[model samples]
Each structure stands twice: as C-alpha cells, then as structure tokens.
Target: MAEHRRLFFALWPDEALRQQIAAISATADWPRGARRVPAAHLHLTLVFLGDVPAERVDAVRSVAASLRVAPFELSLAGCGHFPRAEVGWLGCVDAPPALFALNTGLRQRLRTQGFALRGESFRPHVTLARGLREPPVLPDYPPLHWPVSEYVLVESRRGRAPAYTVIGAWSLAPVSD
Candidate 1:
C-alpha cells in the first residue's frame, strides 16, 4: 500500500487574527460535548485534498504554484452550523469575488492534474467547533475583517492532538482593476 498524507490548501491567519478568532469562539454558546477548534488550528480551508500518495505531493505543489489570485479582504460576519456535519462555523456575509476565482481555478487545475475532488459546491467557512449534537445559536458579532494574502499547502497529523503543518505557501498577486 502506498503511504498517503492527509493534506489541504488553506488560508493561514497571522497570530493576531488567530487570537481574535479564538476569542470569539470562546464566547460562543457551544452545545454539550462540543470540541472547540484550537487557536493555532484556525484556518479557512480552500480545498481539502484528503490523502494523497507521497509521490504525488510534487504534482499538488505544481498545481498550487500555477495559481495567481489577487489579495482580497474577507469579512467574516456571521455564524452558522452544518447539522449533517455537526460543526459550527464562521462565514462571510458577502464573500469577495477573488476568493471564488481562486477556489474555482485551483479545483479546475487540480482536476486536470488527475486529482479527484469532492462534488459539493464551495461554501467557504472557518470551522469553529465540532462534535455537536444539535446546532447552537451562535452569538452575533461584528465582522472580522481579514486580509488574505497567501494560500498554503497544509499537512494534517492526527493523534493525541490534531495538528496542521504548513509545508508550502504561494503569495497572491496585486488586485487587478
């Protein structure tokens, strides 16, 4: 059997933003048995690549390298829950178009590279907590403005504590007017 690594592409936030997100999460009324996502693990996933064979890592990197998206401000303004997934999340009220462009471009390119992606429609969100029995009504908060400048390839290690390590990153280009 080939060795596979669990990986995904995501927007890793800086320390300040990470702390802010954590603080907001701390204030939420999570349901019993809810597991709050750790501060260090807070990220907005662009595409979940799942498990990829070790040899195919280079192909994934090449796909990311070819993407050129402009930096955009993302306003995380609301909270919601995915009942089926049993997770609560933070989402943008009005997502910037650049975000969609980048996601679509990456998915298309990855498919062309022979990677099979999930068929679900893109719903960009930051998972705040998991393992909820029923969705909680999250407290309303002011919009958290996030300046997205880069995307990264992350490796997820599951064990005593789930951890994510960023193996590669690509900077977004200037906004085209």
Candidate 2:
C-alpha cells in the first residue's frame, strides 16, 4: 500500500501573533465540551490537500514554490459558526483583493498540476473551537491584524491534541511601491 499523508497549505503565525490569537480565544465563552485549538497549532488554512501519496509530495511543494503573489495584511474581526459543521471561527469581514487572488491562483496552479481539489468557495478564517452542540453567543471583538508574508505546506498528525508539522514554506514577493 502506498503511504499517504494529510497535507494542507496555510499561513503560519509568528509567536507574537500566536500569543495574541490565543489570548482572544481565551476570552470567548465556549460551551462545555468545546475543544479550543492550541496556540501552537493555530493557522489559517489556504488549501487543503488531503491524503497525498508520499511520492506526490514533491509535486505539491513545487506548485507552492511557483507562487508569485505579494504579501498582504489580513484583519480578522468578529466570530461565526458553521451550523452544519458545528465549528466556531474568526474571519475577515473585509478581506483584501490580494488574498482572494492568491487563493484562486494557487488553486489553479495545483489543479493544473493534476491535483484533485474540491470546488468550494474560499472563506478566510481561523478555527478557534470545534465540537460545539450549539453556537455560543460570542462577544464583539476588535479586528486582529495579521501581516501575512509567507505560506507553508503542513502535515496533520492525529493525536490527543492537534499536531501539525510544517513541511515547506514559500515567502510571498515583497510589495514594490
């Protein structure tokens, strides 16, 4: 049997940002049995490439490396819940154009490389809590600004806690004024 790994591309936050995100998550009034994502594992997934065969990892990395998008700032404000998924999240209310462009272009590139992907619209968000029976009434939060500079490929390992291993990273091009 071919070895397969669960993979995804995401924007990994720095320690300072991670701490800030964790702090905000701490303040949320989560219902009982809700599992808050650990600060170390907090990230905004750009693309989910589920269960890729070991030999195909290189192709996935190459697709990310070919990205020529520029860095952009993302402001995550407010909270929302996916009723069907029962997932609580923080998201960008007014996202910048570059963010969408980056996702669209990246997905296109990956698809062109013979990777199968779901045709779902991209909603920029960070999962804060999961396994909620009902949506918790969340307080209004000030926008958290994130200066996104790079995107990375990550491997998800199943365990008691959420564990993610960064496989590779590609820095976005610096903006030229």
Candidate 3:
C-alpha cells in the first residue's frame, strides 16, 4: 500500500499583505483551540483534492500546468464564522467572474484526469482562524487587495493541526492568439 496525502490548489497572499491581515487577526478575540493561520501560510484555496496517492503527483502537476487563466486582483472585505459557531474567516468582497471561471475550468480538467472532487461550488475566501466558540463580528478595516499571479498544488499533512506543503505552482498569464 502507498502513502495517501491530502492535496489542494490555492493562491498564497503576498508577504506585505499577509502581514497586514495577520495584524488585524491578532486583534480579534478568538476562541479556545482556535488556531489562527500563520502569516506564511495565508492563502485562498481554489480546490480541495483530498487523500491522493503519491504516484498521482505528476498527473496532478500536469493538470495544473494546463490551466488557462491570467492573474487578477483579489480583495478581502470582511469577516464571518462558518456554521455560525466554528471556523472564523475573512471573506472576499468582490470575486470577479474570472476567479470563478478559473476555478471551474480547473475542476473540469481535474475531473477529466480521474480526480474525484468535492461537488461544492467555488466560493473564494481566505480562512483567518478556525475552531471558534462564538461567531465573529467583523471590525471596520480597510479592504485588503492584491494581485493573484500564481496558483499552487499543495499537499496537506494531517496531525494535531494540518500543515500544507507546496508540490507545484502554475503562473496565470493572459492568453494571446
């Protein structure tokens, strides 16, 4: 039997912008056992491909390489909690059509390559914290915006807390005839 790893596609935030978000998250009164995402690991997940065989890594890389979307601007607008009980997060205000299209295209490509995916529609947002005891009331913060230039395929390791490792990255450049 081979080792199984959790994989996903995501867009990491720029260093400066990530730092700014971290500063804001620090001010929030998070719940117990809630782990705030580290500044280095802040990202918007595009697809969650859970528990794949190691042998399939190359195939996944190829699927990512074949993507045809250019970089676009993404902005963080507000915060909210999932289930209104656990999982606090900052929400994306205006996710452009290109962002949805890009995710949809990637899902189609991955499906063609025999990768089973979660059947949920893509909702682009960055997770700020998890395991909250109470719902969060978002503070008044100026919008945080940044250009998304690349998407990465990451392997997530399960443990006391999940840790992510980047396996491959695809740059998004505009198509030319």
Candidate 4:
C-alpha cells in the first residue's frame, strides 16, 4: 500500500489576531451541540487538496513557491452560519481583490498540475465552531485586523488538541508602509 498525506493550504494567524478571535468566541451564546474551535487551530483554508502520495508534497510546495502575492490587510467583519455544514464562522464581509487574486493563482497552479480541489466557490471564513443544531444569532463583533504576509501548507493529523502541522510556507512580498 502506498502512503499518502492529507493536506491543505491555509493562512495562519498571528497571536494578536488569534487572541481577538478567542475573545469574540468567549462571549458567544453557544448552542448546546456546538463546539468552539481552538484559537490555536484557527485558519482560513485556501485550497483543500485531500490525500496525496507522500512523494507529491514537493509539487504542492512548488505551487506555493511560485506565488507572487503582496501583503494585504483584512478585517474580520462578522459572523455567519453554514446551515448544512453546521458550522458557524467569522468572515471578512469585504472580499479584497488581493485575496481573490492570490486564491486564483494558487488554485490555478494546482489545477494545471492535475490536483483535485474542492468545487465550492471560495468564501473567506475562519470556522468558529461546529456541530450546531441550528444557526446561532451572532452579535456584532469588533473587527479583527488581519495582516496577510504568508500562506502555508499544513498537514492535518488526528490527535488530542490541535492536530495540524506547517509543512512549508512562503512569504508574500512585503509592501512598505
């Protein structure tokens, strides 16, 4: 049997933004079946490339390395629910062109190289909680500022606590303030 690894590409948050998300989650009137995501595991997935042979990791890394993205500022606007998915999420109400462009480039490369990607249209969100019986009423939240400087390829491993690993990362070109 061949060994394969489950992977996805995502934007991991800095500590400052992580804390703000944690604060927001702490105050929610969570539904009985819902479980809040751990702050440490918070991330916005760009592309979910299910299982791949272990040897194909470099191909994934090459796609990441070829991106020419610049840093962009994103503000966490509000929360919403995916009814079928039973997921409550925080999302940027505004989808900046930079974020769209980056997603396009990265996914295009993956597709050109024959990798299968999820068919859903890209929606920028960080899942806040899961297993909800129904959508909870999300109250207004102070916007959390996100500084997008890099994207990483992460491996999802099942374990106690957060089960994710940063296999590789590439920085977006820095723009001077």
Give per-model TM-scores. 0.95, 0.94, 0.92, 0.93
The candidate scoring highest on TM-score is: 1
Give per-residue CA lDDT, model 2, range 1-177, as digits (tens).
999999999989899988988888898899888888888989998889899999999999899887788899999888888777778888886888888877887899989999899757898899888887777556766788899889899999886765899989999995566
Over the full model, what C-alpha lDDT does candidate 3 score relative to the true structure?
A: 0.83
lDDT to native, each model: 0.90, 0.86, 0.83, 0.87
lDDT of model 2 at position 133: 74
lDDT tens digits, residue span 9-29, model 4: 999999889888878887888
lDDT of 3 by residue, 65-142 (tens): 888887789888888877653777888888977789778988899899999998677767788887777766556899
What would you estimate as the lDDT of candidate 1?
0.90
Deviation in Å, model 4, residue 144 alpha carbon = 1.0
User: Which pairs clash in model 4?
Assistant: none
Clashing pairs in 1: none
Can you write out model 1's per-residue Cα lDDT over 57-132, one digit (the tens) per residue? 9999999999888899999878888888899999976898999998998899999999999865889899999997
Which candidate would rank higher by lDDT, 2 or 3?
A: 2
